[model samples]
Target: MRFSVFTLFPELLRPFTQEALLGRAAARGLLAFDLIDLREYAGNRWRKVDDAPYGGGAGMVIRVDVAAAALESLEAVPDEVILLTPAGQRFDQKMAEELAQQNHLALLCGRYEGFDARVETLVTREVSLGDFVMMGGEAAAACLLEAVARLRPGVIGDEQSWRADSYSSGLLDYPEYTRPAEWRAQAVPEVLQGGNHAAIERWRRDRALERTLARRPDLLATAGLTPQDSAALLSAGLSAEQLAQVGAPPPPRKSRKKTPAPAVPES
Candidate 1:
């Protein structure tokens, strides 16, 4: 996937992309980045890309003309142009998956108070990291980029790793342990150590359901639960009524095998 980042401070984005998973992906050509300096599009001799809002706001607003010009300079139009701002749709795993399917993306990072309202016209979508405000959108752009890029095929060393990531399956990830089986007097779950593939899978699913139920029951409302999932959650101590509240069907009842009457001493 190709990503074009428009920011006044391209320096902030460079260090992140040059390290970790992103760096490896870029080196492998599985991902690409075009870091455009928004200041280059500034019309003034001073290269000023921001100005005080017309209505007299406290902080300067990124100029629409500069932002639009920077976008137009791209070699090819991106599949999606995203403007980062707090007023936009919330970014999530589903959105990341959707973006990974696109061939190219352009991320416009706003500085100062925000982008000029007209700047919205040039982008295909507006997205926000969360409800809070930040110094600028550069960091958000980096975060958004990493989220989308990792979903691309072969970017992550283990594809199953991403599938197990929190929210990938609409449930928080199950607990994970590594190396030292016993740490500080705490031992890893026996189910994990036992080499029973089926049992281990069951254990992971149950833990994931339980953790999601305890921490973020809200996600369960729309989560796609299989019969196995229902069974797991039910076995994890969630009552049928509680499961119903989250839209999960009741777990299937286990059939009881009646023991035949004991032979009367062969009489």
Candidate 2:
């Protein structure tokens, strides 16, 4: 896959494209990265890319013209043009996998107050990291790139490696341990130590469910819940009351104290 990034601060994003998993992908030509400087498309000697909002705003917005010029210069049409903005859909693993299927991508990184409103019209889609705000979209784009890169064939050594990743199966990944079988008085789970693959797998799934139930019950809303999964949960000590949580229930009401009112001021 190829990614074309349009930003004013290309230097900040350079190291990420050349390090760790990303670096390996780039070296193998499994992934290709292109950095485009919006300033290069600027019309003036100073090459300004941002300006005060037309009506009024606290911070400057990227000028639509500058961004358009950079986008227009691309020799090949991008499979998808993504404008990174907080108003867009929250990005996740599923989205990353979807993006990896695209042959090419153009990422428009916004800064200051954000891109000019017109810039949205130029892109095919928009994505946000989360509900919270960030200083710029470059870091978010880098994160997204890494997430997508790891899913690409030949990028990661083991194809099955991602199966156990948190969010891959809509459950938080089980805890992992390595090296010292006995460390600091804490021993590794016996299931993992024993050479029984099936038992170890069951242990992992059970622990993953337990962790997810404890931390992110919200994810269970749409996650896979098979007969075996239900049985596993039951075996893991979760009662029918917990499985019922997957279905509807009324909002919990506050329990009031039963203290009686005193006939105090009997004036």
Q: Pick the candidate with the highest lDDT.
A: 1
TM match of model 2 to true structure? 0.89
lDDT, model 1 = 0.90
**1-267 per-residue lDDT for model 1 (tens digits):** 899999988999998988999999899999898888999999889999988889675878888889888998998989999999999999999999999999999999888888889988998999999999998999899989999999999998899899889999789999999879998999999999988999998888889889998899899888888778888887778888888888887677789999999878755
TM-score of each: 0.94, 0.89
Question: Any runs in candidate 2 off by more than 4 Å, and if so which?
Answer: 235-237, 247-267
What's model 1's TM-score?
0.94
* Residue runs of model 1 more than 4 Å from their true location after superposition: 259-267
Cα lDDT for residue 252, model 1?
73
lDDT of 2 by residue, 1-267 (tens): 999999889998999999998988899999999988889988899988888898886999889999888999999999999999999989998898899889899999988999889998999999999999988989988988889888999999997889669998888998999989998899998889899999988788878878887888787666777666676666666677877677423324457989997778857
RMSD after CA superposition, every candidate = 2.1, 13.0
